[model samples]
Target: MGHQQNALHVKDLNVAVKTPKGMLPLVQNLHLELKPGKILGLAGESGSGKTVTCMALLQLLNPKTMSVKGSIQLHGRELTDLNQKKMRSVLGRDIGFIMQNPMNAFTPVYTIGNQFVETIRSHTVLTKKQAVDLAITSMEKMNLPEPSKLMKKYPFQLSGGMLQRVMIAISMCLRPSVVIADEPTTALDVTNQLQVLRELDRLRTECGTSILLISHDLGVISELADDVAVMRNGRIIETADVFQLFDHPKQEYTKQLLQARPALLLNDQLKRRVI
Candidate 1:
């Protein structure tokens, strides 16, 4: 067992949406652990509460619509009940997120360079020129084709793939100890996805960051995860090492999920052939 130190620990998490009808539980008894320098993938289809769970960890869920009950510890520090200011300190500094929708990553009026500089300066005492240089450098590291030109334009000026790379650069810039990536490659082509995946692997090797990867695609999990959790109806039906979960899934639900995955059509077809 790799048994690296856990950067994030979640226990018995319960989450509910407070609709006019009543408190409707969306997730129940959800638990997970993410170790530093390792990737933990949460695989599930829509309505599985994958996104909700990540929001809860950052304590970013809309207060009026939802409530979360759980013990979340980040680097041994309890994060379940933190004030907004403290939470902000932790968010950009210790934990960063690669949101599913990169289009919403930038303000319409602000140049990407301006926003990137602001984001950097918010977390550190770096000067405007310094932040701008850092932002361009980070974008270059994320493999953007023309970081200088792209930074001069607004969010609307870039393509979806370009925006995704920019978002990745922003999220991983500070080398946050924990990173939560939700469908990060949803908009990218296969080649770009592979590049991003390779960069993500480099992040772990370089920073020892713990990554919580949420994707509907099993292929992403297979590529990046050190551990795998199969989630259904907001619950984890199976948790195991990446290889074990893929090779020998124990739960019926997990098996069904893998079989249903469009990416595994070959395996699903072969299983029927053998049977």
Candidate 2:
């Protein structure tokens, strides 16, 4: 597909951090595209620059400490040119972000309802009562128990999995065109992880939302990604359809990654395997 038709397009992207020695490259000459209603998995080991790429895409990286160079276009609009204030409006509305740690996504002092309602109100002309109703409805759709009560509870009162689901609900509630989920299931148990993954898949299918899913877990990627990109040492070495990359990887590094999967995790049938 053409660049203009893509949900997200990144070209010649480079990120570097300033160090006492000099500028140290973290990600170099990266190119990526996410089509609407598709999930693109970014798989790499820790420090492979997956999270850094997400941060740069969202303009969350500190300009003073890190240099980000590239063109990031969402639905043909250049994001790199937007100032912080304009970027804030785009975030949570146009592009949603699910952080690696859900706990850090919200303020501990605020009740879940307070934050959720405020978020809705900020994005739309909804009143407090309307926002509250919307928050409850969204949470219920995520299958969170006692949505109303959950909203009244503090962030500390919820489990990691619940918090993650809450984050997903809030992110999807706005119906953003693109979502960047950074290691969303890392902190959850197997059951919660599966639930989270299922919820993401449902939301994407229902909303036609394009997702850039960043995760070290190949299992998670295999379960959801339509396309996959393998990264090593801050650069993407291979990109292909998910099945092609898993079944017939071209790069030796990609082969090693596939081989490194636990025997139990690998099955004769890809669809039958549980993440």
Candidate 3:
């Protein structure tokens, strides 16, 4: 889609960190676009600048130590120009972020309900009771059992899987236009991974929320992403439709990545045989 039609657009993006020597590039000349209600998967090996790209898009990196230069437009609104205060307003409301570790996403001292209600209240002018009700409702939609109970529990009390779902619920409660999910399912078990993936799929299909899904797992990307981009050494080596990239990778690096995951190929074969 064109820039005007995109839910999130990034062009000529570059990120660098200051070192004793000088500025060192971590991501360079990157371009990405997320269409409304679609998932774009970013796949790469660890240290390939995938997470750095996400941080730049969210404007979360420290400016004193890092530099992010680019045009990041969310629904045609330029985000790079916005001040920190303004960016805070846009973050959870306009763009939701799901981190790799759910535990790190929440405050250990606070109950889930406290954090959820506070987040909702901060973004919207809802009273505590109203926010509580909304949080329960959103948790229910995520298929969490005993939504009210879950809310009352502390983040440390819940399992990683449940906590991830709670995080997803919180992110989706506002129905942000775009969600930047950075390795969202990486820390979960098989069943929980599937559950998390299902919830993300439901968000795009039901809520019409666009997602930029960053993951090292090709299997996850193949399962959930509509389009895929391959990053290596601070640059995008290839990008194509999910099927096209998987079946016919153009770059040697992409080919090696696919080959490195023999189990993914085996799993695909097993499913096909069962079908």
1-275 in candidate 1: lDDT tens per residue?
26554799999999999988999988899989998778999999888989999899999988889989989999879898888889998997899899888887788999999888888999999988888889989999887878889889999988787788898899888879999998888778766666667778778877888899999888767778999998898899889998899889999887877777656543344334322
Candidate 2 residue-wise lDDT at 59? 97
Per-residue accuracy of model 2 over 111-152 as CA lDDT, tens digit each: 999999999888989888999999999999999999999988
Model 2 clash tally?
Answer: 0
TM-score of 2: 0.95
- Tell me model 2's lDDT, rounded to 2 decimals: 0.91
lDDT digits (tens) for residues 1-275 of candidate 3: 44458999899999999999999999999999888889999999999999999999989999999999989999889999999999999999999999999999999999999999999999999989999999999999999999988878898899999999999999999999899999998999877887888888888888899999999888888888999999999999899999999999999999998877536643464345322
Separately for all candidates shown, the number of backbone clashes (residues 3 or more apart, or on different chains) is 0, 0, 0
Local accuracy by lDDT, each model? 0.85, 0.91, 0.91
**Which stretches of candidate 2 lie above 4 Å from their native place?**
2-4, 262-275
What local lDDT does model 3 show for residue 143?
93
User: Candidate 3: how many backbone clashes?
Assistant: 0
lDDT at 30 for candidate 2? 96
Give Cα distance to truth, residue 141, candidate 3, Å: 0.5
Off by over 4 Å in 1: 1-4, 264-275
